[model samples]
Target: MSNERAKILIVDDDAMNRVVLSDLLSDEYDIIEAKDGDEAIGILETTAKDITLVLLDMIMPGRDGLGVLEVMNEKGWIKGTPVVMISAETSTPQVERAFSLGVTDFIYRPFDQMVVQNRVRNTIGLYLKQMQLSELVTDKIYERTRNSDMLISILSHIVEFRNGESGQHVLHIKKITDILLRALLKRTKEYKITEEEIGTIATASSMHDIGKITIPDEILNKPGKLTKEEFDIMKQHSMNGAKMLDAIQFFKNEPLMKFAYDICRWHHERWDGRGYPDGLKGDEIPISAQVVSVADVYDALTSERCYKKAFSHEKALEMIRNNECGVFNPLLLECLGDVADTLPKELNDQRTSKLSDADFEKIARSIFESTENDTENIIYEQYLTEHKKSQFFASLQHGVTFEYTYEPSMLKLHARNAKALSFPTTMAEPENNSEFWTIFGRENWDEFAKLLHDPQLNNDSFSFNSEMLVKGKKCPCKIKVQQCWNRRDPENPELISVYGCVEFFK
Candidate 1:
């Protein structure tokens, strides 16, 4: 629609027909030619995003125009790029079939130059306007989403501040909920969730504990275990949170508000009907609430609080898997296990300082200074690349892997490896785990610690061979360790944690 010429793909088996169409439109538009459907599809596959319109012939040798249309439909290119059919086949069935396959217009054989140019111009113009409208709507939706997330974050932080929390709880819950939902989608289509819904649910999860704002400070931040009456009073936050949302008459019917209400009211409910506040069981609980419940419990366990010391990531996960905290949906528990290895790193990243909205805008402007109009396409392409990379790594991983956080002194093992080795999947304090000490003994631990701290050893990495006391017999193994450091303050580098693996010898 701008002064720049739009690119049009001309597909036909007949060389003369392709030349005629190209000559008619090449004055106003850039024309790309393809002799057959296969060639056209190849071009489209690589440059579909750049193509503005496709002039396709109905019949050709090997994968005709209709076949090309089918491929375009499958790949979702037809939605954004307009397709016009150029052929002599004007029968109703053939035309109807082409239309059904997403053909925009048909220019009959012996095409007049003026008629061909007009149709091409109209189709491209119409699609351009439609695309512009779609982008405007998308931008509006994103703006609204950002505003809602900001308000919810501010309100959630207020509640956390009042309750004496570290203020990262809401962010942790949101991230965990998103990870769990995506993992759940991979495992089953039972929930019928979309990428957009995953984001909405994660945003709504922040308000899950908003009802705590209504509670008295004494009961909310009790230093010790609450009395029976105080516990009963404490359980009312879920219902109170729901009631608060219900009081907002204007947004009562909104989907996001409804999600927030469901999560707030039912996150405390358990899968076995043993939980308080209405005792939802099994699938009776909403998926959003179910996900937030697991996230909330995991954060609660791993986070330090007034009443209890923080458990290690390994210990918290072990507790949930064993149903020590409470019963959870088996599928959700499996989803939790799937993301277990990445959770600690993801949460730690969240703990890092985040860019403010203005900072984000400044960075975005700088990145888009040369190609401001292509910002959306650039982001979409990056997302596709990252998604492919995630899938690639997920499939590529093998053997056992584990991570240890230094401050928390928690060690987490691959779930399958933990089960195979007869070791707890997660250990809060490895030194305190009798089974852990039994397998790798205190003497080996002392030697391992000394090696890790030795100045001569590499600061980032060290390896050693040791014998594990397995089944009252010693088995030789190799241990590899990689240290993670916090370099936020370059002058005072801090050791954050280590990730390592063990290879047992036969």
Candidate 2:
């Protein structure tokens, strides 16, 4: 489509025909010649991705044009590469058959050079436009998918963080659910699940424990075993999570919402009619919920939690098979065994990779803007006000801007400043970060911490002078801080996070 010439492949047994066709369009296109179907098939196998169009001859020695078309169809090259039959065959049945086999156009024998050239040009142009449209659609779909995954990750991480579970628990559950569902598909057709349904179910698996957000922190993070009464309260999270999705009103009927509600409420159920909230027996539980249940239990057993040490991969698998955790669908249990060897490595890889603070904030901002709750709307407005102020201050000064959240203990540096200082854009647990401590020095950090903790200065904007190591050189800088708070409860405001900046001064 650009100035670069499109490559056209001409396949014919007659050398003269090839030369005639090549001479007709060689000025505007690069041409490749094949004397027979075998040679044409060989060229296509090696270079079909680059070849724009195929000028195939119907009657050729050793594999005819139709044979080549069949092969192309089998290899899936026919979809992207257009084929025009430049053949002597005149029968309607043969022409129809070639069209059925994916020939875009058919030219009769002794064709006019002008007609041939025009048809070839038009076909290439049409196919190019179609390909471009396909690519654009694919890109849009990919972007939507990425944003959906980011939001899901953010929501799941919030629940996991609050529940004191490993950060990778949601990811592990997602990956394991996907593997098991795919394996189940191969093992039987009892569920009649489509590939698209598999994806939806796997994605919804991340929200299986979303209800835990409603649980009290004391019960959610208790280091000791929960009492029966406390455990019963904890188990209510499933129903609570379902209620959250059910209350969304607008998207209640959407497939993802339905899947999320099912998984949230039913993932904790068991196969033997002994599981909670409404003990669904066997297939009474949706396959989506069943698969996530297995994934959740497997991840819980193999991952170290606040109350228990991690079991080995083998031990976890043994426990599941022995029904020590809970009874599961037999098909899913077998699916688990099928993927047992890959689970440990997959989970380990997930542990090492985490979302950056900038990404988390971006997702948080998006979620805040979209939430329907009045309380969240108030917080969102407050966040927007602070964010605008931060942006204005950053624009007015040549300094490093940063934000620190108290509960998660994350410090995020401005993108440019982070690059200039050779520091991570986001550092979790700044007090424990060696790089942060090295830059600010422990004494300076302690003073800063003390200042932030002082009740009298809690809501005040303040500044202090400190020496910081910048690129191995000590520089005196003035640091300004602003404390952010959730004023939803006017009488009892809560400190949420802090925003600050550092400017080097002589």
Candidate 3:
């Protein structure tokens, strides 16, 4: 591997410096030369493959190294390319600016060959190490992604399998979300969301209701009325969904997990603060939550559930229109109008449940006939909102089962669920011993220990024992504390972790 030639791009107007530097490192690397920043960018604009490390000079005539960096940032052609600033200008401000613009490291003028090689090697190695760590993390995430995708597919299947909605509810929601989010991007000039990000977000959105795994199939598939308490318990699904997402932190930045977490937690929240568990109102909710809210409600209203028949797109729009300012974001409601007719058609909502005025009133009348009626419903009178809770719950009744929540926390996971799940219990000894941890982890032991020591084992009950952790048999890799060895695999690369164990090739 050491014999492998690293590709180095040299961008400089200085012939002498380039010659000297190239002569020193050319044997160890395949040196690519560009006289100026514009030329360097032009080279990169075409087939500049495998060009890893860039030794960039600060001052050039037409477009300097800084200008090249600016172009690179704009194009975003490369993800984590390392550019080291090689310059005569060693002033504090200039060096600071270079570092600020994401330069990997700096090498000054009158630089020694040994020092230059060391800095170049250090930066390249570090950059390579970061790339490897990212790959490993990505590999771990990809494995989790595959697992999540299967789990979500199963949940989605459960919804359609029993409820008879086509196996495409989630697929449609994913598509609609993509369309609207892209439209919003175009309209609002929002952040640059990549295709990968969108794909992952859509995929993750599919599993937002996987917490229904914990819900009983009877209540989930029931074609009848759930008592108020049962309905409240049903609400816990959202929290359950969020809890499921939090359990596998390996998928943190994966868009689907993020979308799933948001939808699972806040899908039930009202635009007004009247929503349950956490009475989050309006924009205080996550934008992903808001987007899914619009998508989810629109799908549910137009599709049949067990308790009621589906409203036609026109009626669905009317309901949304009635909702106007309070229930749905008025702007999003307006956006809904743009896609209204085509959406159901696109989603292939062939089993559209036809409903009469009686059916509407059957749903609408629940609040009116019940003693729970207060000024709140009367205030939103024109809206005629039956139940945000019911809408979510009835989704299951229609076989549109999604994951849900009992409460949302400051971090967005349901604190009740996290606190409940995070509680540790002692693992029973198994012959293999690994199975004990494989099933129930050291976390469980720590929690049990905490509870043993303290009557109340709260979230903050256990202080992390760094030394004990280091000495543990699991020997889980901690590459950051020392250094990382890069792996070439993009999908699932192994990260070579260097521990703090003191050793050398003596």
Candidate 4:
């Protein structure tokens, strides 16, 4: 099974050709000889798993090399096995067919022994290396996922410890989130959600109420409804949790951490714009948070708390349906409806009565140990390698990306590798810089505003270039603008956000 001594199947009608190839490869690989395509197909059907490379002949008496390749392709046997075509034929169509049929390399007749040996060895080496690299990448992805899960579990347990609960609240939220997310992936095309992203969102759901750790025990475990001042103090947890993550250097730029921060800070936001520390309405809230919000609310309604008894599944669904909790994303509500019937059974299976003090302490210690170990540096390095290779980062390294609020406020001056555009780095509010407009000029701003303000203008998206005042000189800059809004509000389609980026002409 080792690639160094992998099996090679040499298909050639000519006895001398087969002998030469076998003689060349026999020392390095176990060789199999097939006189024609039929014999090759038979051997492959019988022992394809053992073969690593194929030296196929183009010219043969019956059912030639191309025919055998067609069979291999049909059987899905051509993927891992490298096929080399041995041919004297010069016809363009014949050669193209061999290549098209997934030939790895073409070795022409009157071949030098060294050339053939080198080609076979090199092809095998290249493919083996590729396979190894793919496996390494898969392992790295698994490691990242495991670390993320462990971190979230630790944080969730901490939240439970503070509230004096069994910690099953976070687990319940994760379960419901997974079901809802899976339903969303199956039912919607409006948002592009990948399987990996689903796992990240579900794991991050455990930290949706992580901010609750900041709230005083008296407020967190009130046993009665919180007073106005206590409630207000409790609401600050979202922002506090976000700021806490922001303080960690390694977590600042991680995508998973970013999702956790968003979920923590914005899960309270309502689709109707009534709920929040930020009053961010509808789609302004990230989907990561929206999904968790529904899950958290559902779990809260259905689970026993210090202040309230667990409600029946039907009653909980009724309350959510009537918007008794708060306005939720309509699409998410649809996802909830799709999975509602099965939730009770899922919850019953996952329910935990209580967590012993020792177990809670053990989990907390493991979390602290993990933090002390600084595993984030490993994840950060992996993320950096991948991020550096991305085209988006490459573009930012050469220029700046800017987003504007519907209120016409500058979101941020985003640039990677360096400050591609000059902005206030020390001022209390860099966005207040009047010179911000100077980079794009009035004409460019007018076009951008027109796109953002007018729903009909160029289908609400446009790209153009204009001369801008950069560093006290006129410079041409490319600008792209797109209109974004809260999709939950279809009645009023006003743009709530504008994403635009500028690049200096090279």
Candidate 3 lDDT over residue span 351-376, tens digit each: 32322334344433432343344532
Worst 10 residues of 1 by lDDT: 384-393
lDDT of 2 by residue, 112-211 (tens): 9889889999999999899999999999878657656765765676676566565678888888888898999999999999999888888888889878
| Model 4 Cα lDDT, one tens digit per residue, 122-169 | 999999899899999999888656555555655665676556454588
- List per-candidate RMSD values in Å: 14.6, 10.3, 22.4, 22.9
**Which pairs clash inside model 4?**
none
lDDT for residue 211 in candidate 1, whole number 0-100: 79
What stretches of model 3 exceed 4 Å from their correct place? 1-3, 12-14, 34-47, 60-64, 74-80, 169-311, 314-506
lDDT of 2 at 252: 49
Displacement of the residue 277 alpha carbon in candidate 2, Å: 3.9
Query: 339-401, model 1: which lDDT tens digit per residue?
Result: 999999999888522334463333333322344345333432332222222222233235345
- Compare candidates 1 and 2 on lDDT and give the better one: 2
How many Å off is the CA of 306 in candidate 1?
3.1
| Local distance difference test scores for all models | 0.78, 0.81, 0.59, 0.73
**Whole-model lDDT for model 1 versus the true structure?**
0.78
lDDT of 2: 0.81
- Candidate 2 pairs with clashing backbones: none
